[model samples]
Target: MDVVVARIGKAHGLRGEVTVEVRTDAPQERFVVGRSFTTDPAQAGPLRLRSVRDHNGITLLGFEEATDRTAAEALRGTLLVADVEEDEDDENAWYEKDLVGLRVLTVAGEEVGEVAGVDSRPAQDLLVVRLASGREALVPFVEALVPEVDVEGGRVVIDPPAGLLELDEG
Candidate 1:
């Protein structure tokens, strides 16, 4: 399966480097030198990474195909995708790719939302769910809150405590 690792941002300087909006949790592992990625438009890449740098906590990437500012600018808004192999051994952990787009439901089978993304934080990971009412909720990715993740069934069973789901609401 192809998982988006980052999106190309503005051209950083004259030498083909571009700032990237990282989409994955493992940026250090993904943005290595000589790593290649396929692009969303299917034409901007397969781009090979020639350089990777960090400036003020921003990730800057240089592609072999993009040798100048004009070349880098052309890649703006392009998503960098990498092929991922699902780990059969680790049944407990779900990749951010696997979690996104899954149906969110209550234990009673009430449809609540769809998972928009996973927020990897220092304290705990959050399941960013786009609710049926169009508001987004950040459910803590814990066993107490999320009891079941049925990937093949395409649903996640969440048991939110009182007022937990309404925390994001106005």
Candidate 2:
């Protein structure tokens, strides 16, 4: 499947170079010359990496056709994606894509809801679960509250503290 790798930022220089906010866990080497990826599906066509270099902590990329500052500026905010094969991860880790739409169950095996979405924040990530009562609950994605996640089984076992569900009712 195609996964988002980065987002094109402002033009870096007069040449066709642009700053990119790296989003993928893969290293910079993976985005080197000859690598093929796509920018915004609506506007940009396909982009083949002519070269990729790091400046400070941000990434600078040069695409085949983007030969000037004006061309690079047009690509600002475009999401860059690369086609990748499916792979397994370590036991405790789970992909955000896999968590969406899975059922959520309490520690005692009581069905609470389905996962509506996942939100990443500076303090902590949260699981937006759509409860059976048709209410939304923003549960903290922490080890204390979320004990287990079974992607293949399509369920997440949670251990919500007292009054957690009640807070969602208000």
Candidate 3:
């Protein structure tokens, strides 16, 4: 499984260097020279890092084949991905891929819906759950609401406040 790590922004300098918006927690070590990673599966080849340096706060990377500004500019909007070989298990840590398509239930085992998506906002993260009635509920992914998440059983137990889902009922 490959997880997205960065996105190519624009050409940085005269060389075939492009500004990269990193999405991964480990950026410095991941973007080292001679490192090769795929952009997309549909694309033919992987991007081989010729050189990597920080410009201001952003990461600038030069590819192996891309020689000039024109070549680097062509790679803008490419999504850099890294292969997830092993599961890095941490307490209370959940991968976005594992949460998607899992059944959402209450603490007492009342079925709410299936996990649709997880939105990471500035203030708090939201769990978008698709209910049995075909309606979507944006439940806050807080400690009080989401008490238990069983990844192996493919279920998430949420204790939402009264009328939280009812208020948005159509």
Candidate 4:
């Protein structure tokens, strides 16, 4: 359930602060003083957050052990992750991590596929569904097309417009 929260960028200053490009939607909640996270290289650390600040629209972080500029500089390009969390108000909403294995179906209960991945893009996010034919279907993750998401039922109901499924079905 470890989800990528941010990627460490260049060293910010001699104060052991490093710039971090946030990956999570809730950056403020993920990166804060005393917060802790494990890294990718496995050797970098299960870093503990020392400080967080903003500069020129960039997020900067200071970890407990990265006490010097040289120490922080060595952590460039590191990824930060946190445990998955759920909220009671999360009805009809889902995180990409939680959607990866859900079943996909037409509104009428016809099976379409299983969710293999989710592509987050600038224009729109897409659900990468593995169809029954062993091929992939890229469905736009818009509310108009995907009207229902039943996480408990482990299925998503998609109401695609005409000719939409045809594009990937062939």
Query: Which candidate number has the best TM-score?
Result: 1
- Candidate 2 structure quality by residue, lDDT tens digits, 81-122: 888665655576555778999999999999999999776544
In model 3, the Cα lDDT at residue 39 comes to 81
**Steric clashes per prediction:** 0, 0, 0, 0
Taking the tens digit of each residue's C-alpha lDDT, what string does model 4 give over 1-170?
Answer: 68877779898779899988776667778887998899987799899999998888778899998999999999998988788666668675567777888999999899999999877544677888888888888889989989988878899899888877778453
76-156 in candidate 3: lDDT tens per residue?
A: 888888785545766576757889999999988899999998775445778999999999999998889999888898999
After superposition on all C-alphas, the RMSD of every candidate to the true structure, in Å, is: 2.9, 4.1, 4.2, 4.2
Which ranges of candidate 1 are over 4 A from the true structure?
95-97, 107-110, 117-126, 142-144, 167-170
Superior by TM-score: candidate 1 or candidate 2: 1
Q: Write the per-residue lDDT of candidate 1 for residues 93-148, one digit (tens) a residue.
A: 78787788999999999999999998755468899999999999999999999999
Model 2, residue 23: distance off in Å is 2.5
Displacement of residue 22 (Cα, Å) in model 3 is 2.9
Per-model lDDT: 0.90, 0.82, 0.82, 0.84
Return the top candidate by lDDT: 1
Worst 10 residues of 2 by lDDT: 21-30
Error of 3 at 114 (Å): 3.7
> Which ten contiguous residues of candidate 4 have the minimum total lDDT?
117-126
